[model samples]
Target: MEFANEPIFQWMSQFAYQPGMVYAGLIAMMALSAVGFPLPEEVTLISVGILAFMGAHPAHFPPPYEGAPVVNVHTAAIIAFTAVVASDTLIYVIGRVFGRKLLYHPRVHKFFPEHMMKRVEEWTHKYGAYACGIFRFTPGLRFPGHLACGMLRYPVWKFLVIDGIAALISVPTQIYLLAHYGEPILKYLRQFKLVLFGIIGLLVIYFVAKKIHQRWAARAASR
Candidate 1:
């Protein structure tokens, strides 16, 4: 609760204090995140966990209200999982309705891009339907990957089963962990933001460098 003094915590707590607002916010944010909004879903779920742990419910709000409702961690987790599945399903439906045409559209192309789309397509092809499960764990690939699955005519049941399993593993775990062990984990996250970013940057650089080297080696091999 003392962590409410932090700006990020305070911001989330504001919404959390309002009855039903936090669930609505989480649904919107998680849906957008699954569809490729820049904000990561994990962070959002973790924030919700921290807020729930801190008891940032209507009952905790300061004012004339003497008895307010408590925040429901289970409800929050369920909402998050549903939001993720819903968003991913929306994209998959778009791909199914439009088929290959969706991939060719200029605006959609921007999200997939040519090279990145190719990589995702390759993985999906190599792994078949299971790619849905794999892509669930790979952030940059999720949008294009799921879209490709539908465009490629993957079965609906398969997509749902694979994706749901992956989401079950990821979405609920973060919420449960933070809801229970939130204080220390949140403190660690706040303290290590810079470190986390630095590691992500380094990984990006390494992958780019490795790709460049591979291309160079291929060209030299023909000579």
Candidate 2:
């Protein structure tokens, strides 16, 4: 697979004008992603970041009408963090609830890709499912990472910590970039062919590691 293209960004950009749209959208996006439905967050994040830069909302400062100082970067970051945490928390609940039977059942297999399922199996074995943190930003496996965590029987606290750490690393940078450069970064993205390919390459590495780990684990079990 490949990193997402302009169309995804374009679609998300359409929602930029709606009031409080990104607040809702950000929550939904993270929630859905946590549940194993993958959407490229770059567009959603950039849109939110840029909109904050524009008048749709302010990134660092609260609106003038609040009769108080506008929300600052620190506050904005906290709010953004809350949205992601809420979404990931829901997915963690799904994992805790349905993990044991997810892959063994026939219906789920139909909905999920077999190869990726096998890969997740391997990755969970190696990293103990909390590795969802590691796979959180991987191109194709970000959502699957959550499902894999459940399948591996990862503890909730460990899963949360790992996922939280990963989010802190990824979310802030996207927000910072958008807050500063706004939509222009999106334009720059269109021209960066190499970056798109690099993303695909990283995803390739992620799956490749999964395959290797699975093989190694099977060998160890047999021994």
89-155, model 2: which lDDT tens digit per residue? 6655666678747644554443345577677668778877557777777745655567657655677
Question: Measured by TM-score, how close is model 1 to the native structure?
Answer: 0.77
Q: Which candidate number maximizes lDDT?
A: 1
Show where candidate 2 strays beyond 4 Å.
Answer: 1-19, 56-76, 183-223
State each candidate's clash count.
0, 6
* Alpha-carbon RMSD of each model: 6.3, 9.4
Candidate 1 clashing pairs? none
TM values, all candidates: 0.77, 0.63
Q: What local lDDT score does residue 207 receive in model 2, on the 0 to 100 scale?
A: 57
